[model samples]
Target: MRKMPLRELAERAGASPSFVSQLERGRTSASIGMLRRIAGALGLTVADLFTEENEVGHRVLPRAHRPELPTGPGARKYLVSQRPLRNVEVYVGEFDPGASTGDEPYAHGDSQEIFVVLGGRVTLWLGDQDEARSYELAAGDSIEYRTSVPHRVANAAEEPAEVMWIIAPPTPD
Candidate 1:
């Protein structure tokens, strides 16, 4: 597969270089308008960007079959469903105490995220918002919010915090 620098792609798409970088890194979310522009520039449909091409008679993703991707200095584990019919992506994340995804603020297109805290405390910062909301979440505490707003997640406890996240349309290129 051919890959392009985010800056070049963003320039071609008339988007900010930083914004494009964030999207590529999955550090920020994008708006619907932004996604359209990017998809157009990349010669891909939004669905094509988010969905994996189907193979005939493919088996499901077993619990142990999910690939783990790096999430900054912390661990963000994920499992894309075996069935390709779903429109959302599910991730299981674990953060060490005081670890954050990044310090930058990012925005994305028409996406929603629901985070269920499995243990410890989590601090969330929303786009340009001055105040950071801290939640002392246990096994069942959940918070759902729009992904369009720039946001960041951090572990604010002495122990590792576990979270389950679901994002719509997935993170874009």
Candidate 2:
């Protein structure tokens, strides 16, 4: 497979070089409009960029090969699934004390999501601000919900927390 240089992609997409770099590194999220522009520049649709192509053989993706997605200053997630993404995507999240997705809740595409607390304690907030519900999860606890509504996750404990996230039919934006 061929890869486009970050600078070249940024130029083609009419985005800042730094923004493109951040996107490539999975350190940031892009708006639908920006995603469309980037995909168009690459001669692909937003879905085309995410859906995996059919291959004849099976492959193994070692731990080192997993992509890291830094959500914020003190929180990070690792994409544990193979690329390009398949029907479902898995992520392992690590959050330091006081770390969170953000102060405000955010929503993704209409995919179904499951969050499992692997270790430590964390809190999950879901739905719109007016009717938001909060859940405190400990190790081994899990919750399932749709990604259409806004949500936020945070580690309010003094210790670090680990969680697993599973999403089906990965969304483009």
Candidate 3:
């Protein structure tokens, strides 16, 4: 893969270059949601950050063995059942207090994503931002929408929130 310029990536991810440099040098770690946005800007899934390049088969991925990263100040993320060349991808997102997916919504190709709230509460903004319908979800709640439609995710409560996302046709590009 061609490497993206750090400054360019920082701009695209809405992060400061100094912060991105620190992250690259292991001096700091961005939340999983933040990392996801950076990856998305680079045409990759957050899972891509921790993905192994070796060819492998479908095997059980123990929680302890799963790769994790921070998304923002108070968020974390995990890649579950990651098959680099497969057609499906699974992700786990943990948000603390004010943590969120991002400030803007994004759309992609022909695909749908399933969002399941496993703990705490979260809000989903579906459709155009101006006229988006807000869907508040609590533990055990689930919702699905097409990737072609713009959408966003955010924590809806003061407590921490955990959610799982199943993406079809694999994750982003």
Backbone clashes in model 2, listed as residue pairs: none
lDDT per residue, candidate 3, 1-173, as tens digits? 42457997788788999999999899998998889878876556678778776556668889888888556667788988644535577889899988887788877754778989999999999998899999999999999988888988889688999999888765344
Ranking by TM-score: 2, 3, 1
Query: Candidate 3: lDDT of 164?
Result: 94
Candidate 2 per-residue lDDT, tens place, 26-48, comes to: 99999999998988665456986
lDDT of 1 by residue, 1-173 (tens): 22556776798689999888878799999888888888866645666557655543656777677868667786576665433324666777778888877777556654688878877778766656566554456767888888787777887678898878787655443
**Estimated TM-score for each candidate:** 0.58, 0.68, 0.62
Best by lDDT: 2
* Candidate 1 TM-score over all chains jointly: 0.58
Ranking 1 against 3 by lDDT, winner: 3
lDDT for each candidate structure: 0.70, 0.83, 0.80
**Candidate 1: which stretches are off by over 4 Å?**
1-64, 82-85, 129-136, 171-173
Model 1 clash pairs?
29-107, 29-108, 30-107, 30-108, 30-109, 31-108, 31-109
Candidate 2, TM-score vs. the true structure?
Answer: 0.68
lDDT of 2: 0.83
- The per-candidate count of clashes, in order, stands at 7, 0, 8
Worst 10 residues of 1 by lDDT: 78-87
